[model samples]
Target: MTGGISRVSYSGMLLLGPGTLPLLALLALPLSWVQVGKLNGDVVVQCDTLEPHISWTLNGEQEPMAELVAEGQNLTILGLDLPATGNYSCWAGPVLLDTTYVVVSSTYEEEMDVTCQAESYHGSFHCSWPGPPSAVFRARLTHSDGSVGLWVPVAGGHGQFSVSLADPSFCPFGEELRPLRLHLEGLSDTSYLSLSRHFFLRDIVRPDPPQELTLRWQGEQLHLAWAPPASWQLPKSYFALLYHLQYELPNGTQVERFVEGVEETQVQVGAQRVRISCRDPYTPPAWSPWSPWQDLNAPQ
Candidate 1:
């Protein structure tokens, strides 16, 4: 025994302890591979040995995925966890006999439902879904014109989590009419998502409704006026603001009027109920919410 490796003679059947797991150890192939299932999985691998002693190691490391106390012809791998996914090799009395590549795999579910909506056309959007707390998620915007945003992660899980996108520049004002589409993707070893949410940006227009709607009877002709809605950003100076004025008459006929440049702050009107919302003509089609209904001035 001078600097030489000794080969153990492999023969026939070898018996183990009464409580040992029964595994069929096939010794035909020079190398064998095994795939283990997830979720408290258990699999048996055949090894080349008829002796009452065997040792296992993962990726040829001192730390083995299988315990060393048990020995013989069968190798029982328990609960093939994600970390258990690797090459499993065993040796009988210092002889590299057979190696079993244990590929840990898991089957996933595909029933994640996503609920999303546009919070602000130019600002951002939102989406959420119920998923495994360990599931990984991502979100993005895909324009009909072929433009796409980066895939962002939707953090948190266990039945709930919300992701908010706050970029208004993705689409210019009024592009709200064309709207944008939101695609949410989820990834995990146990779940899948291949769906997206889309809607008319304008349909979700929820800007703070306009305010300061006033009516004054000015010698037969009524005067109506209001200040523009406030904004999160500095007032855009580009477009003179435009207001959509709607009024219901006593006769039941409703009239909608587009008043440009509300700079004058006053208008001659005669109506029962009136509502007003504003938008930038430069950014036409994207309008703020309608102001609360204002009744006609006295003497209506």
Candidate 2:
């Protein structure tokens, strides 16, 4: 061999040997390397070892605590406060394992409004709210004594539900607690959702009964009149003249008369000299203890 080229006698021909066999062998061997890439949110890549130095970049900045796994540890990169738009890249085993579009969020918040009304009964409040179907909802009441009542239910559905107190016992303010509280189930298991404002329960009261019942003088026309009891709080909407008046004559005789919307203190006496009493229409003469009878000619 002369210079850098060496010739060898093989068979009848001459062969040339390369100058740097050791350097060529070194170039042919593969070295371990990871490809560059990006990822957003969460990603899992399986590789030979968990001890690899995982590095990631958001935009061009390096992630503070990037983790790499071998046995496949879950990677959670939530709540990263990423920009509205950016590039996220990560690497695994000398290869670009992940590349994702970073979408910054303005945050998703929902507002719920609820209104409650009392049914026909007292101390009971009903709440109606709007929400999703298949969503679990709960209600809790705070009594006046600083104690909490167990959650109650109204109706459960996707669009709306009616929730109310389990009993009047949970009503702290009694009839005074107009509207009640309603708590919705938040997305997180441990959190609670309460309506921003409270509603008032409807107070439907009985109307006043007639007063100053009186008997008037008319030749053959006896008229009766009376105002209702004053303590009545119910509305006129429910008020109806609902009583039957009966007249009894001096001969131990009786006459039944029907009156409609009549609160008159006096009724026309058809012909007989008699005494009269009144009874509620809904209650039969048997059920009602008749009102004291008034004699037309009786002295005051």
Candidate 3:
């Protein structure tokens, strides 16, 4: 967890230091040695050369060569386990040849409880998932046309990880041709896990609450007015919202009403308090959280 691969080139030999390796192998080396093998399975780390002076070390220490099968340039590890997972460096007469980071494939059940939400249809959204405390997660979005996005590093701790992604091709006014694919990978020092999800943006839309709510008294009736959330898409005719109004009567009775295509309404007075929420009528019927309650008699 605290080791990374730092490469320095001197003369012609490649030098690498022990440090944390990234979930994805991005280090530039003479040969790619990052391998993920099944637990208890056999793994072979081969050097680029077949020199007779070839030697191997595990985690900067002298590996028990006698316990492993070292034939010419090939080092074969049998019954791979957690203790066998680490950086395996090949050496030739004090000169570093190459290093291979070996990891075991996790056998734990896949975690699919990932949640995602978008405030608007602007193509950007955030997703979060629960994972092991020692795991590091990275995510990427696969576009509708089979194009894969870059792997975005997740940020979180205490068994949770989250990342934000966007698709520039998303259009709020156009119908979705295909669902977006999310790919996630969780990596630990000794093991790794992967999960994926497919969903349309409309299913996860959850806009912010309505704004600028006002209540005014006109004779024996109360007039209420509010505006859609600023974060919602523009062109009210194209991106319409449905509002839910609720109030409690002085006698402790609650009344609810739905308003659409309008932002102002009048109701009979004597209501103790009033509140409102809104949602897209065409979507999956998920309403935004209710706005704060406003007392009917508190300063207009």
Residue 120 lDDT in candidate 2: 31
- lDDT for each residue of candidate 1 in 1-300, tens digit (9 for 90 to 100): 111112222122121222111324333332222333444566556676665677777666757655333336766666545555445667766787666544333333345566554423455556666765644456677664557777666666655657876544555444544556776654333222345676654454444556777776667666776766654223435435677888888787788878776532334354788888776564326677777788875455
Give lDDT tens digits, candidate 2, residues 1-300.
112111111111111122111334324522112111222333332323354555455444565343423233223343333231233445564565444322222121154556554323245556666654433355666643335666543456655666766334443224444344444432111111233334333332222234465666555556666654443223433533354566666566677665655565354344244333333332223222345555555322
Error of 2 at 153 (Å): 4.9
Candidate 1: give the clashing pairs.
Answer: 25-46, 122-168
What TM-score do all the candidates reach, one by one? 0.42, 0.32, 0.81
| lDDT for residue 40 in candidate 1, whole number 0-100 | 50
lDDT of 3: 0.75
Ranking by lDDT: 3, 1, 2
Error of 2 at 234 (Å): 9.9
Residue 135 local lDDT, model 1: 44
Residue range with the least summed lDDT across 10 consecutive positions in model 3: 6-15
Question: Mind giving the per-residue lDDT tens digits that candidate 3 earns over 1-300?
Answer: 112222211111121223334324433443233567777777777777767878888877784532467788888887777788777879998998877767777765364589999888889999988776776677789976668898777887667888999987788889998999998876655666667899999999998899898877777567888999999988988888999999889988889999987888886677788899999899998899999988877335
Between 2 and 3, whose TM-score is larger? 3
RMSD of 1: 15.1
Q: Deviation in angstroms for 212 in model 1?
A: 1.9
